[model samples]
Structures are given as structure tokens and as C-alpha cells.
Target: MGVTRLVSRRRQDPGTKWARIAMAVLATVGVIDTGSITLKRWGFLGELTCPMGADGCDKVLNSSWGTLINGIPLSLVGLIAYISILLMTLMPLLPGLQENKADLSRRTWWGLFTLSTSMAAFSAVLLGLAVLKIQAFCFFCVLSASLSILLLVLSIVGGGWEDSGILAFRGVLLATVVLLGSLIWISAVDSGRSANVGEKVGVPPAVTNESSIAALALAEHLAVGGAVMYSAYWCPHCHEQKELFGKQASQQLIVVECATDGQNNQADLCRSKRLEGFPSWEINGEIDSGVKPLSILADLSGYQGSREF
Candidate 1:
């Protein structure tokens, strides 16, 4: 009777119960999302959509950040992380599980979950860059961001620290510190990826090329310097503009899509920027409607380039 009572008391630590379970559920979903992204990158999926338009999906997918070192999909890494976290959190429930449980854990679960949180946050930030800085969006990137936010919430809610002993608390506290320390690292690595690629980057350059510049002589009355294209994934006209640049050249143009429900969705962002229309352009920094030929756009901006637009 005495042994049973002691064992039950030891087993029912409050924080471990709820926090661990929540972590498993949220982390597991994150795994699935990340796993799919990895699989997609392996050429296993074969169809990556371009955030600007569907034309450049393959190009961006094949670009850098599509795979991890040694060709591992970053999504695969998320899967493994989620699976490991699930196992660690549920370990206390295993039959004779504590036999493997150390009296003072390095707090491996806490440390790992904390790491996962940081990675998720970093990924979400990069996704924003993919949209804003790069001016393109990845559907898979959105899915991953959602998963990360979900897991972070789970971790906070599942933590049973008040009921945990000093050792567990200390481990958690340390893990929190480590996660914070990594923010600078995430920011540094993520910014560059955000800056390059996508139509947003290509916009000015596309409008600046030769034939378009010559055409600008005709459109010079518009006083257009900067033109923005509001686009949607389903817009056929946007596809036409992207095609004008051919595959490689098109990706370099900066295109801002305005589809609220777009897979590369930036609902609040588009709203905040007051972006409207598919393949909409802001000529001379003033919003203009419809897809204009490259030459016409150049005239609006007074472009001077030797290359044929």
C-alpha cells in the first residue's frame, strides 16, 4: 500500500501531464507540414507554385532554401523534430518508461521543444520575407508558419513548471534562454533569402529593359518611375506578363499579388498596403490598373536600357 501510494504520487507530477500531451499534438502536425515541404523539394511532388504567378513555381522551388544540407528536405527535419518531441513528451506514460528517465534530465524535451519554437518563428519570418522582401509567396511556407505558431502555443500551455521540481524548472528556464539566444542567428540567415528571388525583385528590372525604355518615350507623359503589379495565382493575364520575360528573366521581376485567398496569401499585408487587382501596376508610384506591355511600362518610367524590353 505504501509503495503504491508513493509511486502514484511520483508519477502524477502536474506540469508533465498536460504540457507534454499538448506538445505532442501540436508538434506532430508541424511534423506533417514540414515533412510535405521536404518531400516536395525532393522532386517527389513535382509542382511548386510561384507566388507571383504559377509560371515560375518550378524555378523558385528549385532555388536555394528548397532543401537542407546533404539534400535533406527542411520539411523532413520538422517531421523528425515533431516525432522526437512526441516521444519525449509521452515517455512518462510508457510502461516502465521511467527506467529510462534520469533523476535529473538534461531537460532534453524542454531544450528540444524550445529549439523547435525558435526554428518555427524563424521560418515564419522568412516566409514574410518571401512575400514582402522577395515579393513572392510559397503556399507550403504558409502551412509551416501556421504549424510553428500552433506548436509555440502548445509549449507554453503544456508547461507544468509550477508543479515541476526545481531541477525541471531550472532546465526549462535554461532552455528558454537558449531559444532567445538563437533569434539573432535566425534573423541573420533568413534576411538574405527574403531579399532575393520572386517578382518583387524583378519588377523594376523588367520595367527598365530596352524596348520598354524606348516605349517609355511615348508614355513619358505619365511620369512613371516605380510600377507595382497586383497579381493573383489564378490570373491568366498575369501569366502572360510573366511569360513575356521567359522563365529565368521573369523571376527577377518584383510582382506583388493581391489575391486575398491566394495560396501565397498576404491578406493583412495587402490590405495594409491597399493593394488591388491582378497584375496591377503602380506607374510612377501611382496605382494603375491592368497588365501593360513591357514597352508601355518603360515609357511610363522613362526607362533607358540597351536590352530589348
Candidate 2:
């Protein structure tokens, strides 16, 4: 008799129906946002122009702090998480999967709570990195974090739990452990990657002499064609671009130092070019930005040489 009454009560819980609807809506938005970022990062889509300005999106995207979990873009992980949340949100509504037993329904609630809580914790850590470490505003990152928080709230209030306090305690414990573990793992990976980049950045231009003569001629042509590579000495990306040219080709290229402390500093010139990012290039009076490949540079400079770099 008691079991039947408990099942009847669970059936009439309004929170279950409303929470399902809310989770579906939130998860859909999350899917679109994270998917767009993932596609862009993977080069399936074009570059994103941040609404906040040029210094906003790319800066955060290119930063060492943004590289999470084995150098994978954080957006990919978010995409998977959002998809999982969406699947879980829809599962309880399926006729065959709906839990008729009261205890099973409680387990489902706990599972949802755990997922949402862990996501929220991770989002909080990302928020901290954005503000304190990266120090840049990213619309996509903020949107993902916001969605995670909303899902967490819905999971808690919409769960319709009789003992909310106990559930809250367990959720907090799970979230804390997940957040700390993630931080430790990410930090270890980041340290190794940073060391590798440091070594690459420190390599002398002489080490790049192995580049072919054709590459040197292309670099010279780019300079004579009124092309300029705007760079800051302190920018790792600028060092990366220079490394691509090697010493001989890089010397022939028209490289402008935009950093105030750099040799032959051209801060005013860079500002006039509206340079807000590192490794911007001016090809025949047209400005193109970011760390461009040598092939693209050859095409832009109209190099008809051997094409061997």
C-alpha cells in the first residue's frame, strides 16, 4: 500500500515535468554555442570576430591558460558535456526508460544532480582563469558557464527531493573533488607545454639557416612588394612566425618591432596600422592578421619561384 502511494506521489511531482523542459532548452543553447567554438577551432568555420573587440576573443583563445586537458581546446570538452546533459535530460521522458519505482526515480535525480554540479564547478574554475589569468573577455566562454550554472539550479530545485539538505551536501563534495582534480591535471599539462614553447622561442635565428633559397627569395619579394610583418618582440606568436622563415629568409623580410622596448621600436606605426594582435601582416597595403603559414604568405606576395620552403 505504501509503495503504491509513493509511486503516485512521484507521478504527480510538477517539478519533474518542468525541470525536463528547462534542461532541454538550456542544453540546446549550450550545444549551439559550444559546437560553433569547436568548429571554429577545428578550422571547419571561419574566424570569429569578437563583439567586444579584437583583443577579446583571440587573446583568450591563444593563451596558454586556455589550453585545457592534453592541449585540447576547452570547447570540445564543453561540447561533449552539453550533449551528455541533453541526453540525460531527455531520458526520463522516454516511455520505456521512465522509472516507475520511487527508489529508481530518486537515483535518476541524484545522477542529474551530480552531472550538473560537476559542470558548474568546472565552469567556476574557467571563470576564474578568464578574469585573473587570461584577463580577457570571451563571449563564448561566459555563455557556456552561464548555461552550466542555470542547469545546476534547475537540477537542484527541479529535482523535487524530500531531503534537499543531504543531496546538497553530497553535490558539494562531488563538485569540490572534481574541481580540484581538474585543476591539478590541467596545471601539470600546461607546465610541460609552456616549457616546450619556451625552448622553441629561445632558438637563435642561426638555427633556421637550413631553409631553402626559394623561401629566402619569397621573403625578399614580400619586402619589396611593400609588405610588412608587424610583430612585438615579447609575443610568442611573433617568434613562431619568425621561426618559420629561418635566419636567412627572416633577415630579408621587413620585420617591424612594435614593442616599446624592442630594437627599432615602431609603436606609433603599429598603432596607425590598428594593430591590436600579434603577428599582423600588411600585404600590398591590405592588412591580414594572425600567425599565417608560409604558403599563404607566398601567395599573398605573388611568389612564382620554386615554391619549396
lDDT of 2 at 67: 51
How would you encode candidate 1's per-residue C-alpha lDDT over 1-309 as one tens digit per residue? Answer: 343110112235566566667767766777666665566554355334435554233222333444456655556766776777767666766667667554322254455446556656566555755665445556656666676666666554444333345534544575466456544544554565445323352222122222344333333323333345566654545666666555445544556655544555554654565533346666666765556776666656666664364
TM-score list, all predictions: 0.46, 0.75
What alpha-carbon RMSD in Å does predicted model 1 have with respect to the real structure?
12.2
What tens digits encode model 2's per-residue C-alpha lDDT throughout 182-255?
Answer: 78866875676555454433222233445677778888889888789987654557767887887778888888
lDDT of 2 at 114: 80
lDDT of each: 0.53, 0.74
Which ranges of candidate 2 are over 4 A from the true structure? 1-9, 68-71, 95-108, 193-212, 229-241, 251-282, 285-293
* lDDT for position 161 in model 2: 64
RMSD in order of candidates? 12.2, 5.2
